[model samples]
Target: MKRIAVLGMPNTGKSTFFNRFTGATASVGNWAGMTVDLMMATLKIGEVTADVIDLPGIYDLRGFSEDEMVVQRFLESTPLHLIIIILNTVQIDRQLSLALQIKRLQIPAILLLNMADEAPKFGVKVNAEKIAQHLEMPVISMSAKYGNQYGKGYDAAIDAIAQTLHQQEHPICVRNISDCAIDDRQLATELDAILQDAVHISTQHSNTLTTRLDRFLLHPILGLPLFFAAMYLMFQVVYTLGTPLQAFLSFGLDWIKVAALEPVFTPFPSFLKGFLIGGLYDGIGTVVAFIPVILLFFFCMAIVEDSGYLARSAFLMDAFMERLGLDGRSFVMSLMGFGCNVPAIMGTRVMRSPGLRMLSMLVIPFSLCSARLNVFIFMTTALFTPQVAPGVLFSLYLFSFAAALVTALLFKGQFPNHDPLVLELPPYRFPTIKQIFVRAWVEVKHFLRWSNQFIIAGVVIIWLLNHLPMDVPPASKQTLSGMIGQAVQPLLQPLGINSQLAIALIFGFVAKEVVLGGLAVIYGASNDAGLGGAIAHQIDWVQAYSFMLFTLLYIPCLSTIAVLKRESKSAKFATLAVVWSIALAWITSFLFYQGARLLGF
Candidate 1:
């Protein structure tokens, strides 16, 4: 297998091309730094197997950022037979500077003029064959989005690489290296000549509705309001559209418990039946049934991303982000982190400044991810009636943003020289439905897989914690949970949470969702109640609201911290996230509880 490396400036569709070539969708977006980790896929090009490594997006090779170092190390250490340099055809001069640097390494490389379709619309064109003749390597002009246009050309490029591999000679040709120095005059003259000989200009209608909308969307005053409105609508859909589906799943699960499990377990003892019905049916089944809501959220996010509105969001927030000690680009990663923190942390590679990347990684975990959304919904819907739940949900999301902002400011104060945000805006295109579905399916599959493990294990643990006394008489309020809750009750009393809810908050340190699972088990033992009745009858709404606040501000999950350690390479930073999050959660919950009490809640 030959190793093929994909390199490009940020947002030049390197990942889009990589996905097309390797049949792997590793999150392509108009925004930069979409692929942070090394994504490798084996593809059969004709009869030969090709291993493709999609590296992080970068502008210049000379940088101290971790992502640039990752790319540099890969190039220096790996035995790459071919480098497919993806360049934006519209920005030829800037793109070719990096191409020239790669050629200096004397490696066989193919210059892929990606986004060829946009060149003419941008009043530029390139003659690929002429450029190839000058550079002494194959040049391919193709749209990665429309693969059929360059399917044969891609194969031919690979065939050319395979044919030349046996001949132990570098294919790069450099004449008068001094002339290609890319200084002011020389670079301009060469670009002019190159454009004169091998390019064409055509006036084409490039009417973009996205650009027109951006006039309002990118307006400083209007942009934030619009963003909040759009986000509010998104959340509303997650609840409004998702409610029927959630209800359907609940009804189905209830039917299975009564119609299926009860009949099958008729001969079993009552405890065994309760274990099967309560633990499996009500516990794991409820978690799994929320797959539709998760998928719906993913699908909506994918559409917004593919339509290129997400980039505008970043552009819109640049000024506000600057004040918070984060670049506008950090918002993109944080937004992705809301879907899942793993990829969001990984997405930090697009930030060129090391300080900003680390800061973004530190704060991104505070973004409430979709995994925590189910817990939020369960808790909020149970505590507040449906009429008041939306406000509670909005407050939780706002708290996440506030926590992240404060964390970023703290880091910025510590490291004062972080680089400011600079990004290229790509022309917006309507995302293909197939692409949206594929990405959504990938996320849904991942969530289901995690739910199967963590949720199941959590439910079982809660069950064991509640039931291990082996049919002893039901414990009173003075039992284990009660004792622990009472011990911590003073610490959380200012937050309006009672001893039982306080105990669940302590258990939430294990997993955010476990807070709900713990409550279900505790209340289940008390009155044979499920999650619904547990929250409705036992926990006060004030306590429930305070619990949500704590959950929002509390330490990130173990996996999130692990990613932070790996990404930041600083145990101190990870520890800071945990400590500060806990402190903030306590402080916030305290204020909420005391304030609510004052307001006579």
Candidate 2:
């Protein structure tokens, strides 16, 4: 198989082009920093399968940025037949610079004028022939956003790959490096000259549709409120609409447990039944049932993201984010962390600087991941009034953002000179069904893939610990899990958390959703009563709030810790994070509990 490396500057629809060619659901965002990792897949053009690699987006081949380093390292290691460069036709003048730099390298390549449909809206026209003639390479104008045109574009793109591969010895005429420094102003001027005669931009004296929408959505008076409202609606969807579907799924899983699996377990030994049915099956079931809520969230997020509203969101937030010494683009990662922290952590790869990525890693945990959301939903519904549940949930989210800001502020000096937000907001494109479903599916799969193993292992471990000491009552003080929880109970006294809650926290360290499952086991509450109802018997509203606060602030799950360890590649850093979060969780919750008591709550 031949090889083609897809390279481009950020927000040029490179990932979209790759996705179209390979049918891989690499994330397609309207802003920069979306594709942070190397994506490789097989692209079949007719009968030939070519190995296609989508490299990290780069502004120049200067090897200064983290993503540039990623591209540099990969290129040095891999042998390639053709270099496919994706360019945003709407940003042709700025986008052509990278192409010019690559052309100087004398590599066999083709320039894909991606997102061509947006060219007209931007009042820009690309003369592909002129670009090709001057650059001495094939140039094809295409739009990945338009599904109808996507097929033709993709087909032509694949054919271009084939053509480039065939011309292996016949390299595109290389431009001389001469006295020009790679990223110098002279080089940029020269690159601009290559397109001066090829491209024309008409004056947009009046406002366009996007400009019209921005008037209301990004209006100074309404933007912040609108942003908060969008966030509120996000949480509301998970709780309001997701609840009935979650209940239905939970009911199905429970039926399978009792009506199907329990009978099969009746003849088995007690230990085996507990291990299989109670430990493995029930544990996996508890987490899997929440898949609906996770899916719903990603679906909503994808719509907002692909619609280009997220960029405006970042624009509105840039001022505040700069105050915290972080880029507003990191806000995207923060919001993503709400769905799942692993990818959110991974998403930090798009940050160009080490300081910014580190800052994002430290801050993302405060974003209230979906795993934590399960516990939040259960506990909030259990203890708070329905009239106030949404508000309570929203407050938790608000607190998360607050915590992240505080975290960023405290650590800002360590990461001095963090990258400023220079996001380019793409035009609002009504997301095709393909775009929405594909993006949502990618996130859902990522959640499941990252979570399933941890869920199963964590569940089984809890079951073993809770069931040990053969004749002892389940989750009693004498049991292994109970003894551990008891040992730590003294530390939690000020915050009013009991042994069961303590044990749940200890295991919740494994996975946050397990807090509910562990509660069900410790409280000996049947699935019929609900984890929330089961827990409502044990703790009052004040204790519940303290409990929720602790859960929110505590150490992230083992999986997150593992990823942090790997990403930061610093054992000490990861250890410090664990210790700091525990201390923070304890102190914050203690303060909330004590302060509330003082106020007569």
Q: Write the per-residue lDDT of candidate 2 for residues 527-556, one digit (tens) a residue.
A: 346566767866788899889889998999
Candidate 2: residue pairs that collide = none
TM-score of 2: 0.90
RMSD (Cα, Å) for all candidates, in order, is 4.9, 4.0
Give the per-residue lDDT digits (tens) of candidate 1, residues 1-601.
6667789887787877787676764432322232244667777665556667787777766545667766766665566667888898877866776776666666678888887776766777788898877677788877776665645655665566566454423333333333444454654565567666887766564536646876777776888899888887788888777767877887888798788889999999877776776655566666665677788889889888877778878988788888877878888888888787877898787666667777888788888887788778877766777778777787788888888888887778775545866677777776667677777887887666544556666666655555656645432444555556677877777777777666556666656656655566666666766567766786688877787888777888776888788778789988987888889888988888888888998
**How do all models score by TM-score?**
0.85, 0.90
Q: For every model in order, what is the number of clashing pairs?
A: 0, 0
Please report, in order, the local distance difference test score of every candidate based on alpha carbons. 0.72, 0.77
